[model samples]
Target: MHEIISGLLEMTGFSIVGWETILMWMIAFILLYLGTFKEYEPLLLVPIGFGVLLANLPGAGLGIVANELVMNPDGTYMTLIDIANNYGILNFLYYALIKTGFLPPIIFMGVGALTDFGPMLRNLRLAFFGGAAQIGIFSVLLGAVLVGFTLPEAASLGIIGGADGPTAIYTTIKLAPHLLGPIAIAAYSYMALVPVIIPFVAKLLVTKDEFKIHMRKMDREYPPKHEIKHMRVVKIAFPIVLGLVVAVLVPSSAPLLGMLLFGNLIKEIGPNTARLADAASGPIMNTATIFLGLTVGATMTGEVFLNLQTIGIIVGGFLAFCLSVAGGILGVKLFNKFTKKKINPLVGATGLSAVPMASRVANELALKYDKSNHILQYCMSSNVSGVIGSAVAAGVLISFLG
Candidate 1:
């Protein structure tokens, strides 16, 4: 019996108690509790929490397991550290997704395909609102510095203000790779909470007068749904032209630009029967999202997440988002001075990180003020404009910092 128990224990990997394992397990449970009960970024948190569990498992080849071994041609193993480290998907994922900056652009492509630019075309002036909202990014950079973060670290933390997750992640990977996980989680978590966050800030910035302000109907008209059915040729031209211009101007933005253009092409041309376009915005996107969230969460193992710096990143990101809200609303209020037809300042809040959610919130707020109000069209323009603005800001940061 004793011998049999010993064999089972060996397979179990550990028979000893240690503080490190205990700490890691506790952190995992906390993540689970928050995701399950509090419903805080659950889609990501749940996957991430599971990843953490896998990472912390005894004898797993995660961070804690490090032994050098080489497999011979016949499959026999050699104990060695000198041979090349081969077949590490984690390393590949890190390099391809995090280091080379690939995933964000692919995500953006899907975003662009699903996005409708008509709203923005109708409200061209709203581009300034998007620009103003990005000012918070620089402000948070300053705040991070004041709080004792290094220049590079501060820059990474500041990107959260752009309200763009991929931008934030890309900047952090280039500037402060160690902080990538925390900064990314903070950025996305806050984005999901935009509906809750922007309201108080919106109400505070603009009075009922501004929130309830009415505007003239857009003079611009979108083409009938099938009016451009034969414009498939134009789709190809659009991507070719926009991709060339953006790629030539900002090589760093090529990824996002390429993705956006590809998505648009897919939408314009019906030839994408492979359903790649649909999948890009559907299950594929969801799967990638789950992987991204959990992988990011997994990086928050006890040793890294338990540090004071993690707290700093979270606080810095929050401030960045808040400042962005203020900047966007202020920009709209300033614009109101010149235009004869005024936009509800509430729509400006949609300039924050959550793309459609921000726009939806603005419309909802507008409806609350007046039942007959239909502000979504205008709010959507500002929302898409925010995406561009965020991407532009991110490109600038990458060019200057990276």
Candidate 2:
């Protein structure tokens, strides 16, 4: 009877549960609370939180992926059928979709369909700040290497600065798949906290007078001598021209930029192609996001996520985010010194790729200082360009490290 009892206890999963598992459970609960109650990135956080919960459950094999099934007997890639048989559903999802580097570019296509490039085309000068914003990516790359990370790991961590979740995910999967859980969580969490972070940093770096620079007023005083003739034609041709230019310089970026530009092209074609754009940005994007979130969260097993490395990712990711914002602000400050038409520093603050949220936050900051200072349109110029800039930066890292 004593031997029987010992065997039963030893065989039970509950008996094997350790402090690491408990900690992971707590982390899952916290993420759930943030997603449910706080409403921070509910779409992403909710799925990811649930995935984390499912992965940490005692005795459950839902999160287990058979890593050995990567290749077959002849050294060929396993079919999805084989993967499903050897690996579980979550594992299948990770290997088939996320691991193959499939979904991020698909998500980028949706982002492209939803994006409006008109603002960026007109305010060409403002686009440089977007390029400047990428300074955070390279900055953290060196920072991570100094702190003892491999180049690939550092490259993956650095992309958190881009503030574009899909870009960060794609980069990590290519360069440091092991760090995906931490990197993805960090990237999306920081993106969600854009409103709070932007204001906090603006308070420290931007002066009251600097916030009051009226972008619209400056535009009126220094209007271009001529309006862009055949605006529709220009809009139609922009994607094609830019895609070719990007392809020549950074061919690796094609997987991301190619899809993005194609999505935009469909959107620009107007009513005749509205159906394609709608499907790309709506149902297709939504489905991809749900699967992406759940699978990414499942990757955060207890042993993987509960470590000093995750702590480093959390801190380093935040620094990358802040430095990107600071870089954009300082870039504009430097530009202001050289040019006669002064720019509002808040315009630079919108250079992160958090989309309309970043632009909206900057616009609100401007309004707080002066009621008439609406900078949303100007903000979008850099905001959109930041999307392009971050992808290019990711390609650069991959080319160098991968």
Candidate 3:
């Protein structure tokens, strides 16, 4: 009777549920609560939170398991069958999808298909703030190295400042694959918190008068003496020219930036290529996001996440995010000091690559100070440029580090 009961208890996984497992469960619950009740990045956090739970459950063996000896004899990766046997299904999926560095660029294609560059083309000068926002990435790179991280590890950590989850993930995969879980979690979580982070930083740095600065009024007061001719042609040609330039200058980034420009190219080409655009933006992107969230969360086993390096990532990533936001705000302020035509600091605040969300947050903040100040278009100018800037920054890092 004793032997039978012992065997049953051991098989059930009850005997193995320790404080560490419970702690991971609590962390998973927190992610779920934030995604569910707070409605913050539900698409990402919900799947990730559930994956964390599934991975931590004792005896499930669903999480990504490490095996240094699983490579093929020829130095290629193992086959899916071999991976599934040695690790779990999650590990196999991760190796097949993520380790290959395939999904992030595919997601970038969807992002490009969905993006409209009209706002940016109309207001080219605001793009400077987007470039200015990249200061956070490099600054954090140096700071991280000074604080004891290796050069590549610091580069991966620093890319979080760009506020582009795909860029961060891609950069980490190349430069610091070991830190992917913490880096992805930090990047997306901060991106989701755009509504809060933008406002928080704006409050600290921007004055009430700066927030009240209406961009349209300034444009009306100092109207452009010249307008871009054949705007449609420019839009169509810009992505192609830019892609070629990036290919020459930063070939490493061609994978991501190339796909993005390709998606944009198809979209700009109109109905002739509409199907490709739709497929990239809809079903393909959705599938990639699901796999990304789940696999990334699976990498968050207690042994991986519950470490001092994770603590550094959590803290360093926040600083990088804050610095990026502050850098944008300060860029506008500095530019305003010299220019008669003032730009709203809020426009700069939207320079994060979080896209429409960051732009929306900045637009809302602008409206809070002046009810009629609609800066969404102006914000998009910086927002979209930030996406390009971040991807380029990732490319630069990969070129130098990887």
Candidate 4:
């Protein structure tokens, strides 16, 4: 009777009760609640939440691991065979997809396929706001170093400011693989909260007059009917030309930029390649997202995630995001002073690479200040440029710091 009771307890995962495990479980529940009820990045958070639950279940053995015999005494390394034989499936996925640094770039290919760079092409000047926002990345890099993190670790932490999840993951995996889980979570969480964050910062920085400043419609500038053919030609050529220029300047970014350009090329090729574009942006993207989220969350076992370092990362990430917003708004203010065109400062808040979400938030704020203001197109120009800027910044960091 005693032996049976002991076996049952062990089997039920009740025999290994620990504070860390309980805390992790609670954290997982919170993620699940936010993902489900709060609708906070449900696609990513739901899978990640479930992965956290599975990892912390004690007896499941679904988290990362390494064989004792194959691990170096100095804690320096493990063999591929050791990883395959001893680690869990999640570990395999992490090593195969993330450690190789393949998944994030592939995800970028999908993003490129779905993206329409027309707005940025038309506005041109607004694209500079994207580059300005990247000041947050470098600022946080210095801050992380001051806080006692290594250069590579600082680079990884700094990337969370980009608000580009794939870029954050790519940079972190290369520079600080161990911190991937925390950084990814921080990046995605901030992105999911863009609506809350952008409004707060924009309202604080910009005046009512700036918020109400109406942008000139693209139709008035180009007369859509007159420019359709020229626009299509530019769209087809932009990615290729830009890819070549970027590759020549920054070889480290070639893989990511090449794949992105290739995907965009397929998208712009029109009807004949529509199926390819659909596959790249739809099924392929969905599958990669699920695996990526699960593997990232699985890395956050109690032993790895429940630490002071994690807290520091969370705080640092939040500060980085806020600074990015402020930088963008300040950039627009500077631009407004220099140019007679006078852009609405509110659009600057969308420079964080969160795509339509950040742009939409800015638009909503503009509407609140004045219903006549329509800056979605202008905001989108900055938003798309932010995607390019973040990727470029990641490459620069990987080249210099990695």
Tell me, by TM-score, which candidate is best.
3
Better of 3 and 4 by lDDT: 3
lDDT of model 4, residue 349: 79
Models, CA RMSD each: 5.6, 2.0, 1.6, 2.6
Candidate 3, clashing residue pairs?
none
lDDT string for model 4 (66-150, tens) is 3344357897556665566776677778777877888888888898899888888877778999888888888999999999999
Query: Per-residue CA lDDT of candidate 3, range 1-402, in tens?
Result: 999999999989899898888998998999899999998788888888888888898998887765455576787777888898877898888888888899999999999999999899999999988988888898999999998999999999989999999899999989988788889889888988888889999999999999999989999999977698887788899999999998898899899999999999889988999999999999999999999889888878888888888888888898888899889889999999999999999888888679999999999899999999999999999999998888889999999889
Error of 4 at 121 (Å): 1.1
TM-score of every candidate? 0.82, 0.95, 0.96, 0.94
Candidate 1, residue 151: lDDT: 80
Query: Which residue pairs clash in candidate 1?
Result: 48-294, 109-259
Candidate 2 lDDT:
0.90
lDDT by residue for model 1 (1-402), tens: 999999988888586435776777776787678788988667766776676676666665443111123346677543323232452444334444545566666677667667666566546666567778888888988888888998888888888988787677767767777787778878877886787778878878888778777654423232223344434565457567877887888877676767877776776666554387787777766766666655565566556666899889888888889898888899889888987667678667777646788888878888888876778887777777777777777777778877
Clashes of 1: 2
Please give the lDDT score at residue 162 for candidate 2.
96
**Residue 25 displacement in candidate 2 (angstroms):** 1.7
lDDT score for candidate 1 against the true structure: 0.71
Q: Rate the local accuracy (lDDT) of all candidates.
A: 0.71, 0.90, 0.89, 0.85
Ranking by lDDT: 2, 3, 4, 1
Candidate no. 3 TM-score: 0.96
Stretches of model 2 off by over 4 angstroms after superposition: 1-13, 64-77
Give the number of the best model, judged by lDDT: 2
Off by over 4 Å in 1: 1-27, 33-41, 64-92, 216-240, 271-274
